[model samples]
Target: MTQEPKGILIVDDDQDMRELLERRLRRWDLDVVSAENGVDALEVLEREGIQLMITDWMMPEMDGLELCRAIRSRAFSRYIYIILLTGKAERHELVEGIEAGADDFIVKPFKKEELHVRIRAGMRMIQFERQKETAIQALRKKNLELEQAGATIRAHLEAAGKLQQAMLPLDVEHLGGVHFESLFVPCEYVAGDMFNYFELSDTKIAFFLLDVAGHGVPAAMQSVTISKVMNPLTLRARKAPTESSGEVKTRLLNFQDPAELAASLNRMFMGPKTGTQYFTMIYGVIDTEKNRVQFVQAGHPSLILLKSDGELKAIGEGGYPIGLLPKATYFAIELDVAPGDRIFIHSDGITDCRDANRKSFGFERLHEILSAKRQCSMRETLETIHRELISWTESATLEDDLSIVAMEFK
Candidate 1:
């Protein structure tokens, strides 16, 4: 590729000096332009693409020092390299010329070779400045592109968060004579924790809380898929209204069993076809007429039962996490409770929560809260627990998804 030569401007009151410098520099392949004085130099500078200038210190209208300072005051697209020519040998005078923005200086009767070498060095500096400016512009453009991409990602995350929230059951619900309240919090835009409760029949209601193994979009996506399959309407539709009476009765009974449901979900989510993600869950069914609850806990934190007498106990065997083993076994645990008793099911996001000092909010603290708030309304108890957890962490954001469901039998 052919490289375009740079422009060099020479300004001097002496016509001979201007012509000499112009001819010498032009031989070196630079485009040369000359002016008789600083005033004419400024005019030519305005009209030409000048990159380097050699100006005499003394002139009729404007001197080299004044011209250099004037050029420095105005912002230009490219840096201008200026060399001042003067007979003054005083150190202070040289310092003064440099402070006026002169890049270099040459004597009045300078050697041709020395002037050529100095001009060559100045041209290199101009080239370097142009390259630096180009690089800076490129960097700014890249930064702007990255910022735009970040904004786009944030918008998608917000939308995903809204969808995740819609997957949850209402904040408060009532089934038969039992009252339910819940709290959910995710550290990020979406979470791996999910919970829902729905009527299985006139005599039974079912609920579950599950936590996928990780946080963020991958885990949240898995939770969403599971929620859809486990939805009450979807499960009920599987049996169909057209089924024989015996088949419908048996299918509804199977749906009300926690062990059968947990094992089925584990199988659906297991194997290589499901990838390397797994979750812990607790599924339960309440019999309003019999006043009994049947539940299964699969590698999840213990479920808390607060008796009407203000006694709290943790139930269930800490079984293997669902999807961890294809042949994993789960057992149904039944609790026949008196009226006014309450039950609490939660994901490990609560027990595993840490404070600023890295202290875990263990099951002991949870039990104490439940026992103390036994007489409180379901909403009050849930809110108190949520507030305490936030205070312990000292921040609104959590390291994982926080989910809890509490139900009080009336």
Candidate 2:
């Protein structure tokens, strides 16, 4: 079905010329409005949805040029097709016609047939301009909507990041008689690496350093669920305090000694309500008086040990990750911690992390840097690792979540 014609405005000083043009345009079945001058045309435009316009070049008070300029200034309207009916054919006058917003020119005293053909031709131009304006409006509206959607996503991510942080130890200052320092850098705004600490007693502390299988937000969600289940306060104070890093490692490696806790954790995760996301992790306990670490492994990346005497080594054999393989075995290992020895646990995002060149910041290079800087304090050693990793990747930004947990026995 053909849509009705949108109103077209016609302006001229001569009543005869206006009537003649109106009669011909009406024959083509266009709804037309006639104005005696620019002032009348502006008023007609304000009161109506004018889609096209035709005006005479010379008129007292307001001319066609003045009308076109006025049309251009009003941005609220969609578009106006202004074809000036001019007597002069001079080049300078033609340019002026263009500046005044005349889309085309039609000579005065032309044939009625020629005039009819020209107005029809003017319709084609007006339609084209209308289509362009409509497209631009649509694109602008879509762009604004997309920007708002992006902003909403970012806000949610920031809130999630803060909540995950809240699950960790809020006070890193002199907890359980062991000085603790940590550096956690996620590839995204949030990451998969998670750690938790509970003060079981003045002499004994329980904690866990975990890295899920992948990186970014998905992996981060797994850690959040585990943290929720493993919280000692929430679990009726079932967990212990992490007096030292060595204790944390010792507890993680001794998994076979107590399947009860591991089994309970397994059942909790296996519940239908829990998400089916798998993750590799290391959980542990620290004994302040004994100066020991007890830790369990669940197919996580190995631990890096830095001795006070400048010796560096890796710990724990491999095991199956959590949230995968229903009946897998998990075992714990014990390691005696020395007064200046440091144990560093991290996610794959650190070692297998890629640069712009797609090269990994591998374990061999990491050990080399550790051996070189082991003579320094635990804080300096950890920071050196951070710097070397940054230097290896041409682009310092991580492709995955980067997390490094370092604990030194005081």
Candidate 3:
């Protein structure tokens, strides 16, 4: 469909001059509207989609200067490019016309070709204005759509965070004769770190702490899947017994040996099909009957042992992280703990934590805290550790996910 011709308004006190200008513009495919003075020009402006104007300097009611000023005062959806036609050749008069908002000017007795060129230039400017306005409107619409999409994504992330929190063990309880306590803080709404321990049977309990390789939703989702696989009840439910009359089959999974559990998990997680993601973990089993804790380390921070006699020891030979190598093997460290002995397992986020000075809360500081809090209960020790980290960082917010599990053998 062809667009309607652009309308041009011509204002002059001389009717013959106005008609001559209007006829010239109409021949060039412009829709012409004529007015005798500034007052009449304003009425035509209000009634028509006039995009350009030509007006004489001297008019009976209002001059060209007044007409330009009045046109500028009123708001229009499109620009009305104005070219003042006048015999006023003084620099002051030209400046006055410009100050009144005349976009351009032509001298009286102007050549017809020059007038047509000036009019074409004015029309080009009006077309440019229309294009700019359309682009601005399009940009505003796109911005609104992006804002709505962002809001929807935020809501989904909030829902996922709530679900992750609900899966956590809000209050740590004793399993067998060992008392467990924990603290978990994620830098984001969802965390890449997770830890849980539960009773496997009347005389046995199992626990694990893991940190996924990265932060945000991908790591959090992976951590949740791994946590579910490590859950004691879930693991037990997956086990099956062979068919035999009145046969009591031993559990194929060696939950008593942390190295065996690590190997199993490595096999479960390692495959070509698995994406590029891995985690560091400390998996352990506490035999309440034997009074021993056996655990394996997989590229995680060392486990801290606070003995009843105020002795602090770090356990574990740093092994490769799980899911990285298909044939990765793990080694277990077995410790005999009498009553009152405590074991602390944590993610790298705690030891690698940075202070305001960019210094890490290294192993030395960790050892000092453990020795100082050796006489304190498990819960009290955890509180002290948490407090010290916050004080050192000078902020409650951590840059990474921090998780700790303190188990006291009783």
Candidate 4:
């Protein structure tokens, strides 16, 4: 269907001129309206919604210049292009007309073709203004939709962050006569790092810390999945029954070895079904009665051990990261711990943290901090590390997820 042409208004005190212009414009397939003076012209314009106007320079009540000024001062739903009909030929007169808001002008005794060209020019300006308004409206609508989508995504991320935080170890500081302390920070609302320490038996305590390959939702989801599967019930050794005095009794064996646990996780996550995601982890078990610490490092940072006498040691030879290869092998290393010795397991986010100068807070600095804080309590030491890390990076947030789990023998 064709759109209707916008109406044009002709204003003049001369009836003959108004009638003649209307007839000519109608003959050219244009919608036209006419009035004898500026007052009547404004009434016709308001009633007809005309967007183009041609007015005589002089009239009894309101002249063309006065009408132009009035129209420009008032706000309308759309733009109106005005052309003045004037006999004045002086440059100053033309400038005055333009300053009064006339868009174009045609002298008296004008050729019909010149009049037609002026009308066409006015129509083109109106059309361009309409197009610009339409585009601006469309852009505003798109911006509103994007803002709504962003709000929804932010809400979901905040909820997920709370859930991830709930999965962390709580009040496990004195579990099985061993003291535990930790720190966790994420660059975004959700994190890819997880840690927990739980009692597997009366005398055995298990702890683990793992960092997924990246940050944000995908990595956070995978880290949550790993945390659930690494719980004591899933990773604990199977129970067996024995006959004692003809009575059947069941006893708990040792928890799953750290190496076997890593292997199992690798097998579960490696393959085409699991995508290309992988993670570094340190999983350990401490026997309180024997003062023995056994752990596996799956391509994770080495564990830091601070002895009671203030001697420091870095343990573990890095192994393959879990889920990277189908046949990757992991082995557990065992060490004897003395009373008051502290073991630290952390993600690489700490040592790899950088400052404005692009210098990494490497392992050497971490060792120095641990050695300097040896006299402090386990909780104080972990808090000191957290403060130092933030100070080193000189940022409220880090570039990656940061996590650390520290345990001290009783």
lDDT of 2 by residue, 288-341 (tens): 888887777777788777888877778987787766766676666787888888
Lowest lDDT 10-residue stretch of candidate 3? 237-246
Off by over 4 Å in 2: 1-6, 11-15, 26-49, 56-76, 84-150, 171-177, 200-204, 214-217, 236-267, 270-274, 287-290, 387-397
Query: Of 1 and 4, which scores higher on lDDT?
Result: 4
Winning candidate number (TM-score):
1
List, residue by residue over 308-353, the lDDT tens digit for candidate 1.
8888889976987887887788899999888889899998877889
Residue-level error in angstroms, candidate 2, position 110 = 5.8
lDDT of each: 0.85, 0.74, 0.84, 0.86
Pairwise TM-score winner, candidates 3 and 4 = 4
> Which stretch of 10 consecutive residues in model 2 shows the poorest summed lDDT?
249-258
- Predicted candidate 4 versus true structure: per-residue lDDT over 27-98, tens digit per residue: 888988888888898887777778899999999899999999988988888788999998987999999999
Q: List the residue pairs that clash in candidate 1.
A: none
Q: Is candidate 1 or candidate 3 better by lDDT?
A: 1
Q: Please give the lDDT score for candidate 3.
A: 0.84
